[model samples]
Target: MQKKPFTELGLSPELLKAVAKMGFEEASPIQSETIPQLLTGADVVGLSQTGSGKTAAFAIPAIERVDGNLRAPQVLILCPTRELAMQVAEEVAKLAFFKRGVRELPIYGGQSYDRQLRGLRDGAQIIIGTPGRVMDHLERKTLRLDQVGMIILDEADRMLDMGFRDDIETILGQAPAERQTVFFSATMPPAINQLVKKYTKEPVNVRIQAQEMTVPAIDQSYYEVDRRSKLEVLCRLIDLQDIKYGIIFCATKMMVDELSDHLKARGYSSDKLHGDISQSMRERVVAKFRKRGFEFLVATDVAARGLDVDDIEVVFNYDLPQDAEDYVHRIGRTGRAGRSGRAVTFVAGREIWKMQQIIRFTKGKVRRERVPSAEEVEQKRTSEFLENLRETLEKGEYKRQDTVIDQLLDQGYSATDIASALIHLLGGDKPAAQPIVEEQPRREYPNYQSREYPKYESRKSSPRETEARAPREHRESREPREAAARKEFHAPAERREKPSRSPRREPSAASHEEGMVRLVFNVGNAHQIEPGDFVGVIAGVTRLPKEVVGRIEILDRESLVDVSDECADQVLKKLNGIKFKGRRLNVNIAR
Candidate 1:
């Protein structure tokens, strides 16, 4: 069969043009197979792995069917995580780029609900969000699905794994029963199959089997390093390799900003892109990066689809992507248009297992390499400086300086001394050596050539030995069976071990409560810590139920939360030294 182009899919002109601009001339397998079925008003089940273009398959058809004039949600897509929700929303936006009056909103946890409420009030035709956040809006009566023409469960398996089954079912039940349901999952376990049977009516199942991710031209490698040394190692790699231009993929917006700022502070030209950056700012950053105004652009996966630059020589995975397919996407940024590229990933302890999974899924070779040492970095920089000097001398561009050099030489300055002085003047300052922590030495145990077991020996105990081993005084002091049972039932150890605290109470607005002590956390409004987030962290850290946390009071940069006096000390201990959203939480009991 002849290879098909996107035109054959019968997509709208606007969507087709958007696809073309996105550098997609032909429909991917999932898109080609599912879009037509969806357009025909059939409930569809898409079985595809990450990076299989499942987003477009659903997004294109959804955009096509959505009534642009509708001020309410015409489509609702549920994702398992905020990042994935943002990604799906971005793709939907791109596909509808040329379609006027089409609006998409992404709602997820950890973000201010006020922003999401504003978007909802503004009439977004397409709503994409994580299950928890979507449920939150639904509970608050801020989001409605009455007019939703289609419902999509993107990464359905992931949502289920994250314990969103009840939330998803509730949301789906709230939607119009006549609305078309489309589900996409990498695997169809019995739970997912049951969900499909219950929700979808005669769904068309489209399974796009996994294919090997083969980008032979790209050299893939990883280096094992501690979290603290990652920055130092990254800088050394960049300097030692003399990387001209590159994209560094961080996992979160905070990481992107932090890494970008750190790189800039280290005197490297760098910028950042993430969901938090406005579209105009993002466009500006991308434009500058394309023009080589910056040597590095740190970004999260949210910005992955928008990056189309082909001259990127390297893709540094400052943090591994959450999805295995994203690994392919991150590295695929390089080695474009048949040009060789390099992908270097930094793996922390135990993260190697995750990387191994990626290797297996992609069937790609990722060679392990050692991080460049301080001495090696210095040597490489020195060599580069000498080479640059050699090039400058060959170009003969220092004619004006020759007069001063000759005058010094006439005063008995040797040519070597003059060159040394010039080298000292022109060479860039070397970076301070990063402190290295030594690994513990491995101990080797002596190997025995032969195993020696003591010869088996048996002896019979005499009647006198048995009598001597008996506890005569304890036997005489023993009580009758009923008395012994009563005494054991009233054991002091049991009484002491019984919990004295009452059941955990829900956090309230009140500042004080009976039998509870309030604790202060050194992060509040400034850090964007919401009551729910605070409760989540408290529960997560202390293993206490949310109901146990009482009376949360958020101050300018601190928060006071009341907990049972019995567990206040324990809560304080667990909250200490923990970080949330990149800020340390210095938790202590309120005086």
Candidate 2:
């Protein structure tokens, strides 16, 4: 993706300033190609992915063509979902910051109709809405497309797939016949191409070719953890790996702030990057990151655009991106400059299906992995401390403190006891590691929702004191433990797990376990319900934690999931009639 500078795009000085304020230094390929054509009133069929900067491509031209003084709906943009509509509306507002009297309103289902009516009545110059809501407004005559001069359909393929063709056609039919129609889609299916032929007038096709996504040097992997345990798991990973320079990619600015703050409170060196920070502050934060002032720089996808840090050791997708292209872009930040980087994604319940989408899109191998245990982090730290101590002794630095040691030694403290006391005092300043909940027997599952690992907490000790320790024979064998500790992240498909001595067994297929009930859904592989779908859907619909949702078994045409007995009825009540992939869900207790 060769991004074009905005200066070369013929944008007016004011719009350029607005773009600058939006923090984009260059126009993406789609933006550069479509801006000129769109400005000249050419109907465009932009074929690009979600994160290819398509929003600005349509937004800038729409802002340029809107008649601010006239204050009529000169521009109409239709999106497939309320979330996308809101995002597009925000982008338009940002780009139109300098253009006076230009107002953009987002109207979508599940919002207050009275509020939308008020916005429409206020002479909004631009309207962004979903097809269904737009059709509703049109039927009520609350929204008139007669004054619309240009109409854009974003995510056209998605809209058509969501069964919005009739509503979309009706809305377009109501628009002025002479209006310029632009369609941007990730793929040009037959339905979309037919739409282009019938509705567009000799449209200029702007297709961004997919670049060679060569990330062989980066080892990509995913962790199936619960939403509540993400932070703990992230901390454990950072500690175990001792990641010094890394970027933690978040899905939203709020998540960035919360994560950064949480890391700091946990005594981790970290900071945040987002739009809310002043440019000067962002520069300072980036400068500190470059100087290794912090180990982690948490940021959102939009805020990290155009960031050119090459030596990043790792990239953690704190939240899975909605688009597969965005996922690639996020992980691509690392593994640059011929460096072998690590990319880890945290997939919670309901996001399991999304993770698969990314794997299919990238055509790259991704393997499931377990989170580092609390004991593992502690062992790493202790090993590092001893190594540093050895280096200090080799340098003869300990001699400089001999006088203090001599005094303590003379006061009845032996040499080994003195060293242990000093070590204890040094370790006391560090915060105790958080324990991950052990909600179930340890075993590997498709999406190992948090509470997967058993808890391990070290006992506290006084200075120079000792406790009963396990015998060497009974203790964990040092060979396997040391091998596990020394192992590095390998290419997803190339890594092999070290065998454990303990026996492992799969859970019962239909265990109406104590305090839980087995529930079945009329969706499975044929319906495209993969391993994570039942877990994701049940937790998503019921708004319950994934812990209460137990083992899931997906068959050909049906699936069985264990749910807490207390919430079984709630799940049954909430998910009985909901739709999944255009088919109504039918959930019931498994016989």
lDDT of 1 by residue, 1-591 (tens): 122468998888988776654434456677888988999999999997764567888999999988878799899998776546655665676577777778888786555556678778989899988777787688779998899989999889877876778888999899999989999998999999999999999999898777565555689999977554667788889988999799998765556755675565456789988766889999999999899998999987667665899878999998766446568888889988889899999876435555775787877888999877878987887888888878988998765676787899999999999878766655433333364433211100001101222232244532312211334431121111111011011112211122111233444343467888878888765454455455546654565554567777767567778888788788878878966646776987776
Ten consecutive residues with minimal summed lDDT in candidate 1? Answer: 441-450
Residue 535 shift from truth in candidate 2, angstroms: 35
Q: What are the per-model C-alpha RMSD values against the true structure?
A: 22.3, 21.2
lDDT of 1: 0.70
Model 2 pairs in collision: 226-450, 350-536
lDDT of 2: 0.71
The backbone clash count of each candidate, in order, is 3, 2
| Model 1 pairs in collision | 504-548, 505-547, 508-551
TM-score of predicted model 1? 0.48
Clashes of 2: 2
Candidate 2: regions farther than 4 A off: 211-214, 222-236, 244-341, 345-358, 367-379, 386-397, 400-402, 406-421, 424-591
lDDT (10s digit) by residue, model 2, range 338-371: 8888899987643565576567668888889988
